[model samples]
Target: MATWPNAAIATLMETCGEAVSNAAWNAILNIVFPCPTYLVAPEQRLDSSRPDLTVYIVGENGVFFPFEGKPAKFSWEKLGGEVLGYCIAARPDAFQGYNYGMGGNGPECIICEYDGANMRYLYIHEGELCQSDKMHVLHIFRDAAEILNVLEFVRGAHV
Candidate 1:
C-alpha cells in the first residue's frame, strides 16, 4: 500500500502536473506539518542567499529548519553546499552545538534537501556537517512510509 509520503507526492504531482518545484514542496510541507504555532515561509532570504523554505517554531527561543528543494536532475553536492552556506550564514548557532569550552545553548537546526524523488536530512554537529546515518536517503517511491515516520520523529512528534 502507498504510504503517506508517497500519497502526498502523488497528490502534489497531480496538482502540479509536472515535476514538483520548490514552491510546490513548500506548500505540501505546510499541509503535512500544519500548525497554528509554527510558521512556514517559502523563498525566505537568509543573508544574501534564499532558502526554499524556512520553518519557524513559534514561542520563546523558536527554532528554524532550513529546507532546500531542487529538481531530481540537480546535483546534491552543489545544492548541499548552498544550503550549508545558508545555514552557516543565517543560523550559525546551529553549528555551535558541540563547540569546545562553550556552555551556553546553541540552536539545533536540521538542513533538509529534497529533489522531488528523494530527500536528505543533514545537520551540523561538532563542527561537521553530517547526514544522519538513519535517514540519509528518503526515497519517495521506495521508502515513503519510513520517510513520514522519520520526519515526525525529527520534529519531536510521537509517531
Candidate 2:
C-alpha cells in the first residue's frame, strides 16, 4: 500500500454520497497499483448484480473480486448483507466492500466470505475489527501483506 496524503483522506472523509465515495475509493485503489498487475473497475455490471467496484488481475480470465462501496455513514448491516449476497451470487470464496469512513472515524472495509463452509463477515477500520464474524478483520488496504493476500485470493480462486 502507498502512503496516501492527509488531503486525500480528508476528501474521502467529506465525501457525502455513494457515488463520490465510490469514485474516490476507485482512484485511491488505482493509485495503489501501478497498472497491469491488478485492475480496479468501478461500477462494473455483472449479470446478477452491479458491484460498486471490481478488482481484476490482468491476463487472467474470470478471476475478479466484486466490491460494494458506501459513504462515511451507512448501515453496516446493509453493507454486510449485500456483500454476502454478492458472494452467493458470484459464488466466489469471498467478496469485499469499502466504506469511505466509518462514523467519521476513518475508512472501513467489509469482507464477506465462506470459511470452510461457514460464512463470515467483518467490518474493519484501518486494521481494527469492529463487528466481526471472525476473530480478526480483513483490512484489505491497511498494509502490503493485506493487499497481497487479496491478490492471492483472486489468483487462487481461478486456479
Q: Write the residue-wise lDDT of candidate 2 on 41-99 in tens digits.
A: 76566566777777666876542556777766566677766665555555342333321
Residue-level lDDT tens digits of model 1 in 32-110: 5567756777667767766667766666242355666665444545655565555454443422331000000011112
lDDT of each: 0.45, 0.51
Cα displacement (angstroms), candidate 1, residue 143, comes to: 1.7
Q: What CA RMSD would you report for each candidate?
A: 10.4, 6.4
After superposing candidate 1, which stretches have Cα over 4 Å from the reference? 1-19, 60-63, 90-135, 157-159
Candidate 2 off by > 4 Å: 1-8, 11-15, 31-33, 91-106, 121-159
Report RMSD for candidate 2. Answer: 6.4
Clashes of each: 0, 0
